[model samples]
Target: MSHSTVSIIAQCKAAGLRRTKALELLIDTLLASPRPMTLAELSEHDNLNTQCDRATVFRLLQRLTDKGIVRRLGLHERAAYFTLLLTGRHQDFLICTDCGKIEAINAQCPVHALEKEIAQKSGFTGLYHELEFFGTCPKCSV
Candidate 1:
């Protein structure tokens, strides 16, 4: 298991969630994935498909999302994408409009400072932001 996965599992335990087989598999899958996964994609994973039903996956995702262990990316596509939310790790994505490919932007997040400033001004705690850029990828443009 990865450090992120272990941390998330610890968080789940702290939140009173049990360490089920399905939950463990789901976390492993999400951590191994290079990008955010859709419900269909997650359900179709070989390990998860055999062990748990689609409904189980959906419910687990919902619970994790509620607990801030997972993040639902509201991209332009009809399907929602989910990714694990590692502590102190933030990322932005570049989404290809034509092919629907999502790539993590390697640059430092420019919005963190702004988010802090806004939070201080508004007296809000635990403020965070999600940023994504939409454009045609080179493959799609060709």
Candidate 2:
């Protein structure tokens, strides 16, 4: 089992939440998915493993988000998708229009230096930022 999976169970237990089979399945599903998953998509996953209700999944996901174990991405005018955050991976999302797919990208962003430069010029400190890019993906465009 992955450390994240173990940590998730520990977090839930620490928070006074029971680690049900449903919750385990939910975690497994999120970990297995290659992209972010909307609540609806999560409820309807073909795996048919999680016996948890949509609301339960939503609440658990929110808890995970609070703990920084998941990142939420708002896709254009629709419900947000939850992406599990793995240790040591800085992540960003790319959403596809036609298929409603979410892709995670991790790159060593040099923009951090640029941000520092801007902060120095502007006399701002203790600052970090969130960056997002939107466009038609190559598969969607084709």
Candidate 3:
């Protein structure tokens, strides 16, 4: 879901964090982003660079990750990408390698029964899942 500055500020408050200029910029950029963004992309965004550097971006990402405000996706051998999770929807992705687009696919547990069986057989607890599919998007495939 696209977000506005007021909502972002509220999110910060909900996360038990204070609002700062840098955080504002980062949140704004991520909320407006069309797809998951890498550190390089965050660094290059004009709004975040005036006061934020690599380390600051890293710190913000780490903090947000811990707060469950964002999720990281590993795309092939490329830099890890972060997508904001403000909507609180747990979903996977269809990543387009050629165009760098990240589209969220609704969560469907294709291996639900397998997970239960595996847990029972292996005596493991709290099993979870994450999935991603990568290839050229239609625009790029053409």
Candidate 4:
């Protein structure tokens, strides 16, 4: 198994989740994707679809999300997207409003200080943020 797969499995174990084929396939699919994926996209993946039903995928995602191993990103679209939460990795997104395309922003986050300030003032620990910028892409604007 790949290192990411192993790590995901280990995370699941640590989260008190049992290892199963469907869960492993879902983790693999998430790891292979370049960007966050909607439920439809995940359910349609060939390897995953062949092994498990959509409900199973949904349940597993919910469990992982509860365990902080997966993050659900809410865009303007109807479907929410999900991605694996890697340690010490933070990203923001630029989304094309017309085409529903998502692009990762690699620059340093401007809101880190704001989050820290909020945490300090509120005495909240483990504070983080998700940001999305929406605009028309070149093709959509043309």
Query: Per-residue lDDT for 44-86 in model 4, tens only?
Result: 8997898999999999999999999998876545577899988
After superposing candidate 2, which stretches have Cα over 4 Å from the reference?
1-3, 15-17, 46-50, 96-101, 111-130, 136-142
Candidate 4 off by > 4 Å: 120-122
Candidate number with the higher TM-score (1 or 2): 1
Cα error, residue 30 of model 1, in Å, equals 1.0
lDDT of 2 at 2: 71
Clash tally for model 4: 0
Error of 2 at 132 (Å): 1.9
Query: What are the per-residue Cα lDDT tens digits for candidate 2 across 1-142?
Result: 6777887778668866678776777788888887778888887886532476788788878887886667888665778898776655566666766666666666666577888899999999855655566778888797
Q: Which stretches of candidate 3 lie over 4 Å from their true place?
A: 1-3, 75-77, 88-91, 95-131, 134-142
Position 124, candidate 4: lDDT: 97
Q: Model 1, range 30-86, lDDT digits (tens) per residue?
A: 999988999999999996999999999999999998888888875555577899888
In order, what lDDT does every prediction score? 0.88, 0.74, 0.79, 0.88
Residue pairs in clash, model 3? none
Which runs in model 1 stand beyond 4 Å of their true positions? 1-3, 14-18, 74-77
Candidate 2 similarity to native, TM-score: 0.67
